[model samples]
Target chain A: MVLLKLFWSFLQIGLLSFGGGMAALPLIQNQVVDLHGWITLKEYTDLITIAEMTPGPIGINAAAFVGVRIAGVPGSIIATVGCVLPPFLIVLLLVRLYLKYKNLSAVQGALSGIRPAVTGLIASAALTILILILWGENGFSTNLESLNFVAFILFAASLIVLRKWKPNPIFIILGSGIVGGAIYLLL
Target chain B: MEKRKSIYRKLFSSTFYISAFTFGGGYVIIPLMKKKFVEGLKWIEEDEMLNLIAIAQSSPGPIAVNTSVLIGYNVAGLVGALVSLWATILPPMITLSVISMFYSAFIKNAVISAIMKGMQAGVAAVITDAVLNLGSNVAKKKELISVLIMLIAFIMTFFLKVNVVLIILFGGLIGTLKVVLHERRNKGGGE
Candidate 1:
């Protein structure tokens, strides 16, 4: 029963959340943290942090991670299948429509509008992550000492490196891990 | 027939291996797919690959999976599509499952926790970079309507806290309406 519920919830997530992996964060957060009490907000953030560190789309990693925590290996498999099912089927159906009338101006127009909206969604995702990194629990950080200065610095440095170098993400991720470990050990 | 089977097998393995290395989202795989399918295999033309990408972007799934499906379907029909789809997602599913088994130990370690913090910061930066890249490409269009849609969508989500699905729907509606309105204007005045 729990496995079934997990599948259903993630299926809803896969269906509703559009734009990309980042845009799915809020919905996943609500379902896991508020609705089911499967994980706390802090844990949810940590899960995403780990998900980002891992090699996969953020959405897939989150589903797999959360599923395993709630229902073990079977739970993870079911949840992942659920998460992927909607998009897979939807895209498959759309492929027919797309290949047939891809040249239509109306289709082009709709796509143009969607492109910018997607950008906005991605921006908001970054904002959400930024706030979480800077403030511990929620956006309401009363104590300044609780703020993580090292993370803030790392965020800036990472951005600069990415813009200037355009290096492979694996290097950046691994480099951050080493730098973070050093910070933890030294400070 | 033997050659065809070999090609299909190559597609499956190539997609699987490329997918395993995909660290971020679908965006990261686009260039890799181009290299593998376009330059390496010489199976699809450059223009055709671009067309597939455009279609994949407009479709409703992860672009990586969508593109893989598109290319596979183009090459070898439904069976190929299924094969490519499975290949694309297999790595992440396997990796996540293994990580799940040992999650407790990793979570408890202070060193891992700190490393995650740094990685989180790195991820935040990467997301920001994606937004800027997408936004700048949109800016290159130099259309007032597109800019308006972009701003309105941004404000609606960031400030008004409107649901993302609704925003996307609204964008589509406005976009279609804009195109229709322009068409009517041209027909009524010039023609």
Candidate 2:
């Protein structure tokens, strides 16, 4: 029963979570934190960190993580399958539909409109994650006001380097992790 | 024949290795994929790769999975897609399985916490870059409407605690309605 519930919840997430991982965060937060109570808000924050650090799509990672938390290995399989199945099916169907209406003006217009909406969704998700990192649950205390400017600076520099030079993300991740750890230790 | 065989072998090996090693999911893989496919192998051109990314983004599956599938299909055939999908998923599945087995202990480690904090910053940077890059490409009207819808949805979710599914449904409805209304206006003007 629990496995079934897990499967259903993730299937909904997978089906609806268009765009990608960041877009999926709000939905996963609703399911994992608000609706089911499988994880707390803080744990959700931590899971986002873990998911970001781990490989794969954030949505899939969340499904696997939440599934495992709810049940176990079997739950993980169920949830992963549930999360993946919808998009696969949808895309397969879309492939055929796209072929048929490949030149339709309306299709083009709709897609054009959707393109920005997707961007907006992505931006909103980024904002949510930033808030979680900065404010925590209490919502904008003095501590958050301090705002870890150094981290933001590092983040901006990393962005420029990534865009211009295009370094290995693994190296960037590791390097940033070390810098963060050292900063924490120093503080 | 020998050249084709070598190409196939290269594609298989590269996809397999990337799938096995890639961590932190789709966004993380972008830089890696760009490195391997765009920079290293030159299997596909940069503009073509960007187009593929756009297609992947608009499509439904995980971006990494969709990208691997598309790139693989382009390089080899159905086999390439299968190989790439498997490769893309293999690392995370195996790693997550092991991690899940010991999740309790894993979550409590201070080192892990520190590392996670750092990774979060990196992830934030990556996400911000994605937004800016995509933002520039977005058609101007789409950008405005999209950002507005996004802001409304974000406020609703973060503040009012509305269900996300509902927000998506509303967004879709608004999107569809906008198109419909535009079409009607055009038709009325033409008439």
Residues A31-142, model 1: lDDT tens digits: 8889999888887877776666566776678778888888888888888778877877777777788668767999767766666665665566557666776775567377
Q: How does each model score on TM-score? A: 0.71, 0.65
- Model 2 complex DockQ against the native: 0.31
Candidate 2 residue-pair clash tally: 6
* lDDT of each candidate versus the true structure: 0.74, 0.67
Q: Per-residue CA lDDT of candidate 2, range A1-187, in tens?
A: 9998888988888887766776788989998899999879987887776665577787777777777778887888788878877776555454446546745766545444444444454456566655554545454457646576657765777778778876765566567778877776566
Q: What lDDT tens digits, residue by residue, belong to model 1 across residues B1-191? A: 89889878998998897788656676556655765787678888754665565556554546677788888887887888888888887788788777777866766778767776676676666666656666786788899887888788788887898866677777777878888898999999986
Give the Å shift of residue A12 in candidate 1. Answer: 6.1
Candidate 2 chain B, run of 10 with poorest lDDT: B46-55
Q: lDDT score, residue B185, model 1?
A: 97
Residue A171's lDDT within candidate 1 is 64
